[model samples]
Target: MQLVALVPAHDEQDRIVATLAGLYRQTRRPDRVVVLADNCTDATAEIAERCGAEVFVPVANRDKKAGALNQALEPLLTELADDALVLVQDADTVLAPDFVRTAAVALDDPEVGAVGGVFYGEQGGGPLGLLQRMEYQRYAHEIHRRGNEAVVLTGTGTLFRASVLREVRAARRAGLLGGGTGCYSLASLTEDDEITKAVKTLGHRTVSPDGCRLVTEVMTSVPALWHQRMRWQRGALENLRDYGRTPVTAYYFRQQFLLGLGTLALACFVLFAVLNLSVNGWQGAAPFWTAITLIFVVERAVTVRGAGPRAVLLAALLVPELLYDMFRQAVYVKSLIDLALRRQEHWYAT
Candidate 1:
């Protein structure tokens, strides 16, 4: 089967070389590498070409990454065979040398439609970056614990059978999926999450093998992280809303509800603590509560232990991570509010 890699990029001149290099270094290198340059004002296309990757610029596409990819996929999919594989990856991600090999192995299974990467953050975002790394580590541990059954086919890197993508497209056109008529939903902020539901709805399974690992860019600042996550959380809610209550979206709705419940629980806990402190003098912590807290702390530490000393230390400290949790909770709350009001949040380009 022909293996094609498509990197959808917008002004990624600074990192295109490394991305291409990672592809070239892959154990199961792609038969062809194409860079979808989406209205780039920089020399991203030139740099990609310099690195010897075929460049395809989407013509005046305003729908962002999803549109650019659709434009490129249209003609390319026509030329490729049904069994051919397409690796849709971000411009800034670097796959492990064996990523392609591992994902290919998983995709060889007729039951598996796509294989996504187990991604970690790239170094250099400071304390915030470290926190995100730890968060990602915990996420990776959870996925591993679940036997690599993926909840989403992350954009960082994912391998798909051309046939499956064609199926997704057909499903969209037939109104079996949302987004009207595309492999990805232009209306959905979190295309990955939306597409995951689409794939599953079509009776195809997705996997995230541990061996298929990659490093993708992380938000370096609080504002960046906030906007990124807001878009993610809000997009997910919107996607679910669009898809409605179907068997495929039942799990996603539960996940979102639990997140909202968690946020509310945290708020209630803080309020109760303040009220108790004001009503009574400082009372020592209860043994039962302390044990529960310990369990949580230990779970945090153990899950991120693989991230190294600093991550474990941070996770154990509790304060930093707790504050980060509060921040994320705030994002979740805001997303819900935005979704309720049908408020429009401008898409922020990374």
Candidate 2:
């Protein structure tokens, strides 16, 4: 079957060439590669073209990745047959040589509508960078272990059958997705989550192949990491709201419930620690807090072990990453409230 790779990029000149090169190296090369150069002041289009990709630059507001993707979709669908496969990837990610081949083989199963693969973070920026690397490694391992039953929430390196895309597009047009927004834009930070849910709602299966992998570069600084996670958490909450009262489907409901429980657990821990300190002084709660912290450190170490020694060391140095993640969840809660209240969501860089 013929396949097309769609890459949405914005000011990614430095990284686009490497990503395209990786695509070229795929064991099962895509029939065509389309790069959506959204609002780029740089030479992203030039680089993509040089690397043998068909490039499109949208003049309209490049709201975000989703917008660029939708803009590219119409042209691609018009040019290719309806039965073709379309793979979406990020400009900063590099796929393994066999990644596409593996995804294609998995999609060969008629029941599977979409497939996501393992993604690893490249290391060596700093201590925080190492923590990010370890986090990605743990994520890859968990998804691999879960196999096709995994619930995928991100859209970094995923493949979709053209039929699924058409269904999603139709749902968007009928105002069944994203609270009647008429085809969600990439501008809405959580468009990926929305799309994934939409596809699942149509009774098609989404799978993650253990053998397919992609290497990604993580944010090196604490502030950058904070922004990245905040966007993700906030988007997730927003999408959950958009689904409003749909009888909790097992897969989707379980994912949301776990996130909510995790948030509640963290909040309870902080509140208990504060109240104990206020009533009995630091001495009384000191031991308990230390023990809890040690437990967290050990858990982090175990997770980082999958990435090797350097990652473990980085996890040790960045022990506060969990707190940072908690902060992101708090931001997500706030963002969800804002979205519910109809507050505007301004676009920002990643």
Candidate 3:
């Protein structure tokens, strides 16, 4: 496969170097590397050019990352061949040397339209980083369980077939897909998830290949993590709503819809428990709550073992993790309410 790599960036001067350097070291290096310097004020464009990447600073961009990507990819609709592959990697992530090689092997199946690799949180980030590391490990675990059929192709390290992208491009031009530019939605918060559904809705499969992983930085503070998760959860709800509007269920959209319903049911159950605890007193609910807490801690511990002993040890912060999970749960609930009320939400991009 003739490979072309794109890194959509905004003010990524401090970190883009590592990502480019990692790509340069890939066992099967991309034939072309384009760094879409989306309205950057920093040295991001200069650094990408200095690093030997073709830099495209958009004339204008409004939808953040997705818009920047569309601006960059619009031109590629004419540049790519049917046999070409495009890897859309995040500015903040670095990949293993063989990551591209491993993922390319899966594309040989012809039925696969895209490939999403496993991702780990950047190491040595103190408390918040370790917590995020564990969280990512759990994400990887669940994604691996589902094999090659993926519900979402993570932006951290997603490889796409060029033909499907062109099709998406054409669809967007015709106003069929709702992404900001072509394949990625400006209206949705989680463009990766939207792209995954778009590809699947076109009758192609998304693959998850083994031994190909990306490492990315995670939020290092409570406030940052909260905002990030809120944006992510809200984006998910919006995608469900948009997909519902399309009335399409050929691929994973139906599965995601069902999963959303399941989450709503679980949230309702939590609400019932909270109401009972408030009215009947904690004495009666103490045993039930303790068991649930222990289950959460144990499950976290088992999943976090991939990060080594230190992370497994951090899983002992059961109380803090429990509180954090509760916070995330509340975010999920608020997201549902926001979607129902037709409220607008924005990503707190830095």
Candidate that would win on TM-score: 1
Candidate 2 TM-score to native: 0.86
Candidate 3 residues lying further than 4 Å off, grouped into runs, are 245-297
Q: Model 1 segments beyond 4 Å from truth? A: none
lDDT of 3: 0.82
**lDDT of model 1, residue 279:** 96
User: For residues 260-342, what per-residue lDDT tens digits would candidate 1 score against the true structure?
Assistant: 89988989988998999999968998999999999998988988887788999899899999899999999998988888897
lDDT of 2 by residue, 1-350 (tens): 77999888889999998899999999899998988899899999998998899998876854677777777787666666666899999899899999899988988888888887677887677766666677788887777677655366356788888878877777767766653332334535767677777777777788888767888878877667666766776666666665765643555667767877888888897899799888988674467867987787777777869788876765665546766567656776766577679776554676
lDDT of model 1 at position 51: 90
lDDT head-to-head 2 vs 3, winner:
3
lDDT-best of 1 and 3? 1
For each of the candidates, the C-alpha root-mean-square deviation to the true structure, in angstroms, is 1.2, 3.2, 3.3
Count of backbone collisions within predicted model 2: 2
> Model 1 residue 104 lDDT?
94
Scored against the true structure, residue 209 in model 2 reaches a CA lDDT of 83
